[model samples]
Target: MTIGAGGGSRSNSRSSRTNKYSTSKLRNSQHGSGAAGGGSALGGQPLNGPSMGPGKGDIKHRFEIIRKLGSGTYGKVSLAYDHKNEREVAVKLIKKSAIENKQDLVRIRREIRIMSALKHPNIIQIFEVFENRDKIILVMEYASGGELYDYVSTYGSLPEPEARRIFRQITSAVLYCHK
Candidate 1:
């Protein structure tokens, strides 16, 4: 999830170009701090365009929280089950209060906009974004194998073949972003 958005063993920046999603009500909202909490605005259009999570419920209704996957400065990720998809997903939850200012919020939303536009196989896919009064939740493709750095750290270096495979995946994602 966020590992691709500057949260992993290797950090990289996405392009500066504007994405169509940036103009959506969710991204352009004057105050989506979600500080008070409750219900999702879901922007002007419904999330995922009709086929989406509920518009008036806690994120748990659609994604059952499994366990904590990881945590970063801005948010925490939990492994969750997508009831609708009948599969696992990584739920990234960011509290609007955790954000210091509007600038940081803009950067966060920009990353979301960029990530939403991506469809590369090697990259994580963002399925839906749920915004309540205080929290912004993102349901993303689950990487059951976990973070590459965690594997390398626990196993003390990957075998050549495994390392190569991981390298290829990283390079493919990087190249996709470059394009």
Candidate 2:
């Protein structure tokens, strides 16, 4: 998957309306509200299709984990191939234990809700979110651009033109989100 539109053109007014509805739908979804409490994400089952068994079985059945992409405070992201979609996707693996409390869960859910709703060239498209007994799995559009910190660290500094190009892309994405 690429960092591109989810493929449609909507008036700004209508787009915001749909985005609001979509976020609400995601936040209130009972099936996805497991993980944090004593329940399972996807209810310990595969959400998008048939389950392989239990635990990591659902993930194994659906996506082929290719390699590690990166890691954050909660989990690591991996490049995986979605068997159902026939495409590569980035899988964000966040352990249920990693969520410190209800607030963290809320923040995560908010991020997921927003991500699932956004359709932009610079934002990765979230495909599906699920969980095993131990971890929450987020499937998303695969973009292989390395982290900005890593790029800067390796090269020290970018040429003025290169810096401007990166800056423009970042601002445009942020502005899109703001709108």
Model 1, 1-179: lDDT tens per residue? 22333324232232232332232122112323221124444432223311264544334344455567778887788765555555666777787789999999888877887888888767777877766556677777776556766667888977898677677778888998999
Scored by lDDT, the top model is 1
lDDT of 2: 0.57
C-alpha RMSD by candidate, in order: 11.5, 12.2
Model 1, position 101: C-alpha lDDT score: 95
Lowest lDDT block of 10, candidate 2: 7-16
Q: What tens digits encode model 2's per-residue C-alpha lDDT throughout 143-163? A: 655556766677798899867
Off by over 4 Å in 1: 1-58
